[model samples]
Target: MKMVFRWYGTGNDTVTLKQIKQIPGVEGIVWALHDVPVGDEWPMDKILAYKEEADAYGLHLEVVESVNVHEDIKLGLPSRDVYIDNYKKTIEKLATVGVKTICYNFMPVFDWIRTDLFKELPDGSTALFYEKAKVESMDPEELVRRIANDVDFTMPGWEPERLKKLSPLFEAYKQVSEEGLWRNLQYFLEAIIPVAERNGIQMAIHPDDPPWPIFGLPRIITGQDNIRRLLRLVDSPSNGVTLCSGSLGANPANDIPAMAREFAGRIPFAHIRNVRVFDNGDFIETSHRTSDGTVNIAGFVQALHETGFTGYARPDHGRHIWDEKCRPGYGLYDRALGIMYLWGVWDSMGTSRKGVAE
Candidate 1:
């Protein structure tokens, strides 16, 4: 696996490219023009600026975490065609910078949902937490207010400006059912996959966080069967899945290692992390160690190795350890630690296979 780190950009992220360069196996940055609003064609100058920065540190800018799909596209509005065209243009621009994979999601309104950004764990280190009961009971607006006000930095999906019109966004999605959402997603893929294919960029869709419908919003990209359906939508190598472990692991039914093995050829990018699920349907992000969380991270890495995966992968999220006051899930210390744990598993698997062959 070719490891990468997600850097929000120069001023946006607390972790610097210098610090990311110090990580042993990381060779690239999974990045995007975060300031670029969704549905707008990315400015070539901004894209080049990121390239220049990564180039300065000898880090390849080959993977983008998200080129966020607009709600118009997800809702299948008439204006979606314009946004889809803009998406195509953005793909072309990113391709100019040697970006191999563009990760995007089709989830409506919120991209990912969590009850607490810094929920304290038993060990005193905090991490992103999802409380099912709390989400079900809370008002969407209240949840937005709490999340937006609490964080000093802008949350990717929960952009305060876009979410301010929560009532209308929810009302717009009311016309869309799960099947309708699937059809809309297929429409999007059919429109953009050809552009992505021509640009030599694989479009990977991140699975819905928690892998379930939240606050009555329809979530289609939830598991293996849905993923299979998604792949069939475009039926092209350019159309792929991000295969996020923490997102699908929340469901408990997703066989992540099997997914890695099955979709190995198609997946050009991966987000590998661990989350500990509880009897009460809650989960907290944990270290990348296999034993720390419910996800079979080691087995997942083993499957990647067995498949001879040369695609980009990253330590998705880490705990807020060492009193590091950084982004909720994206921190330096724990993520770097997670990377070492992943390397340990991957390298050991390589040695064991070599020994067996000898």
Candidate 2:
């Protein structure tokens, strides 16, 4: 289980590459060119620049969190072919820089929806929160304003430019049901998985952020059954999953450790984080420990160990800690602490395995 950290870029993120390398057992950064719009071919120079920067700090840029697929690809529009070709090129370019996994998603418009960015926890620590009722009833523009409150870095799924076309985009997806989205995702995989396999890059699809339909947008990658079907859709080693505990754990029905074990080999990347889910369908990000949240993170890590997983893992979205004012969930302080907590569990499990072997 090699650990990686997600670092935005040199100047773009408050967490520097230098700080990332100091995190014990973390060997690389999961990154992408955020400035590049979806469907555009990544510039070779920009890829090289990121590579060189990571090298300067004794870190490897081995995993990219995303090479975003355009809505055309997900919507199955005629223009999808052009965007896919660009995506293919981007995959090839990323492979050149030693990126082992490309973590992308197929969610239509909003990537992840949280009704509150900084909901105050009982501990007085503020974390990203989701009020299901609020999300169900709130207008798109109102939600946008809430997310954009005093933050400079753009939210991953709620890109400002795309959000500007809120009404039109919403109307466009009015006809796109869950079935349509699945078929389109299969179409996308059929087109790109061959290239990914040839290029030695694993295309790891991140599960729908909250692992459910939000704002009438159909979400397909939510549970174990969906993952099983997804692997069969492409049936290639290059086609895989970025199993996220918090994302799938949003629904208590999901048996996270079971999914980890069942889809073990197929999952090439992981986002290990915890969230405290309330009975009212609300949730807030929490520490990596199971007691701190609803997810059994230690059990998830142990399952990965048991399944012989030897892929990349990262501490997923973290709370803003130490009064660090940066990206809402991408702060370094708490995430680094999360990594250590995960490492502690992983290390103990490794020792136990070794003892049994001896």
Candidate 3:
């Protein structure tokens, strides 16, 4: 596996590209033009500037975390064709700078919901927490106000412009059933996957955060069965998934390792993180060790290794530790620790496989 790190450009992120290059085994950056308005064709000059910066640090800008799908596309509106055409242009531009995979999601309104951004852990370090009861009790607008606390940097899916139009957007999605979401996603894939194939870019759809419906929004990409149906939607190698352990692991029923094995070739980008789920439907992001969280981090890594995965992998979201003042989950400390843990498991697995081969 080729490990990558998520790096928001120069001023937008606390973690610097120079710091990212120092992380052992991290060869690439999972990035995007976060400032670019959703559905607009990315400025070629701006795209090349990011490449120049990563190149300066000897890092490959190989994977983009997201190029968000506009609500028009998700809502199956007539304007979707216009946005999709722009999306195709963005894909072609990204290929110019050697981006191999584009990781995007189809979640309506919110991308990932967390009741508390800095919930205190037993170790005194804090991490992102999800309270199911809180989700049930609060209004989504209130939740939006809470999550959009940081005015300086914008979160990928929670763009201020989108959230500001929440009422109409929510109304637009009210008629969309789970099947309708699937059809909409199929329409999107059928339109873009061929463009991605032509450019050698794998279009990887990230699973719905928490892997279930939230706030009355219908979620189609939640489990293994949906993944199976998704692969069949376009039936091309360019069409794939960015299997995220923490998102799917929130629901204990998901067999993450098995999904990794089953969708072996289709998954080009892997987001490896662990979540500690409580009996009451709450969860907290934790250390990457399998024992530290409910999600089997090592097992997921092994599944990738055994399946002959040669794609990009990244330490998804890390906890806040060591009194580090950084982005909630995208900190430098715990994520670097996660990478060491990943390398430990990955190298041992490779050694064991080689021992058998020899």
Candidate 4:
């Protein structure tokens, strides 16, 4: 597996590319132009600038975490054609920078949800936490304000500009059911996947964070059968998934090990992280070690190795440890620690396979 790290650009992030380079086996950065609003074509100059910065650290720029889908596209509005065209242009521009995979999601309104940004842990560290009861009982506006105030750093999907208009976005989504969401998603894929194929770029959709509907919003990318059906929407090699463990692992029914093996060749990017799920339905992010969380990260990686996975993978949300005050889930220390754990796992697995071959 080719390991990558998420780096918010120069001024936006505390973890520098210099620090990222020090990690054991990280090969690239999962990045995007955060300043560039959704549905707009990215400038080629900005794309090239990112390439130069990554190359300075002897790193590759292969995967982009998100090219945020426009509300129009998700709403299935007639103006969606304009946004889809811009998306095609954006893909064309990203291809020029050697970006192999583009990761995005079709989740309406909020991209991901967490009840607490810095939920304290037994080890004196803190991590992102999700409380199911709290979510079900809270108002969407109040929840947004709480999250906005949770951390000083920017919460990626909860951009204030988007959250400010929560009422209308929810209203727009009222008419779109789970089946409607699937049809709109199909419409989006049919328009853009061909352009992605032509440019040698793979469009990998991230599964819904928590893998369930929230606040009366429809969520379609929830589980294994849904994923199987998603692949059939476009029916091409370029149409694939990012396969995030934390997102789908919230629900106990999601067998990530089976997903890792079944979608092996199709997954161009993998977000590997662990989460501790409670019998009460809440969950918390944990270290990559299997013992620390309910998710079997070691077994999941083993499944990938067994399938001959050679795609770009990254350690997902990490705990805030060592008194390091960084982005909620994008801290440097814990993720670097997580990377070492993953390397240890993959190396041992590979060594055993090689020994068996010998």
Candidate 5:
């Protein structure tokens, strides 16, 4: 696997590219123009700026975590065509910078939900926590207040500008069922996949954060069959998946390792992280180590090795460790630690395989 690290850019993130380069196996940065609003066409100058920055650190800008999908596109509004055209232009711009994979999602409103951003674990290190029942009964306003509570960092899905109009947004999605959302996503793929194919950029859709519907919002990208159906929707290699372990692992039914093996070549990017799931349905993000959480990250990487997956992969949300105060799930300390853990697994597998071959 080609290791990559997620960097929020020069001014936005505390973790510098210099620090990222120090990680043993990381060779690329999964990035985006976070300041640019969704559906707006990205300027070539801005894209070039990011590329140059990565090049300075001897890193490749290969995968973008997200090019946030506009609600218009998700809701299939009349204005979606305009936003899609802009999205195509953005893809073309990214291809110019040698970016091969675009990791975007089609979830409505919130991209991912967490009950507590800095939920304290018993070990004293804090991580992102999801209380299942709390999310089920969460008031939209309350959720917004909780997210908006942290003004320092902008949460991905909960754009303050959009969340301010939560009532209308929820009302808009009320008419959109799971089937309707699927059709709209298909519509988006049909329009953009050809452009992506032409440019040699893979459009990888990230699965819904919890792999299930939240507060009546329809979520389609959760299970293996749904993924299979999504791949068949456009039937193009450019149309692919991001295959995040934390997202799908929330649902215990998903066989993550099997899914990784099955969708190997089709997967252009991956977010590998572990989460501890309780019997009561609550879950919390943990270290990349398998023993620390429910997700078998070691087995998952083994499957990736077996599939000969050379695609870009990055450690997902990490715990806030060592008194480092940053984004709740994205501290440099634990994630850097997680990378070494993942590399250890992949390296051991290589050794074992070589021994067997000998």
Candidate 6:
């Protein structure tokens, strides 16, 4: 596995490229032009700027976390064709910079939903938390206001400008059912996957954050069955899934290691993180150690090793440990620690295999 780190960019992130460079085994950055509005073609000049910065640090900018799928595309609006064309252009441009995988999601309205950004754990560290009850009971607007006001930096899915149209957006999704969403997604894949294939970019769709419908929004990329269906949509090697552990692990029924084994070849990107699920249906992000959370961090890594995965992997959301004042889930300290834990498990697996062979 080729380990990479997600860097928001120069001024937008608290963690510096210098700090990321110090993390052992991290060879690249999973990045995107955050300033570029969704559906707009990513400007080559801005893309080159990010490339220059990563080049300065000797970090390959190969995996982009998202070239976010616009709501128009997900909603299957008439304007979607324009956005789809722009997406194709962005894919071609990213290919010129050697980006191997482009990660995007088709979740409508909100990309990911969490009730709390810094829910305090018993250990005193804070992590992103999802409270099912609150999500079900709270008003979407109230939740939006809370999330937008709480953070200084712009959150990926909860962009203030986008959420401003929450009422209309949610109303728009009302016309879309789960099957309708699937058809729209297929349309998107059919349009863009060919471009991705030509550019040697694996278009990996990230699963829904909670892996379930939230606020009555339809979510299709929640589990393995749907993932199997998604792969069938495009039926191309370029079409793939990001295979995020924490997102799918929230259900406790996902069997992440099994997923790693089954989808190993298609997955060009993996977000390895752990989350402890409560009996009440809430979950909190935790350390990457196996004992710390419900997800089998070690087992997933082992499966990757056995499959001879040559794709990019990154430690996903981590606890806000050491009093680090950073992005809710993108803090440097715990993520770096998570990387070390991943390396430990990965290296040990290699060692054990070598010993068995000998």
lDDT of 3 at 88: 99
Q: In every candidate, how many clashes are there?
A: 0, 0, 0, 0, 0, 0
Candidate 3 weakest ten by summed lDDT: 349-358
> Lowest lDDT 10-mer window, candidate 4?
349-358
Off by over 4 Å in 3: 351-358
Report the C-alpha displacement of residue 14, candidate 4, in angstroms: 1.0
Candidate 3, 88-186: lDDT as tens digits: 999999999998999999998788889888899999999999999999999998998888855457677888887899999889899898899889899
> Model 6 Cα displacement at 282 (Å)?
0.7
TM-score of each: 0.97, 0.97, 0.97, 0.97, 0.97, 0.97
For model 6, state the Cα shift of residue 312 in Å.
Answer: 0.3
lDDT of 1 by residue, 108-152 (tens): 898998888889988999999999899989999988887877886
In model 6, the runs with Cα more than 4 Å from the true position are 351-358
Error of 2 at 143 (Å): 0.9
Give the Cα lDDT of each candidate. Answer: 0.90, 0.88, 0.90, 0.90, 0.90, 0.91
Off by over 4 Å in 5: 351-358
lDDT (10s digit) by residue, model 2, range 208-240: 979888878889999999999999999999999
Worst 10 residues of 6 by lDDT: 349-358
- Residue 82 of model 1, lDDT score: 99
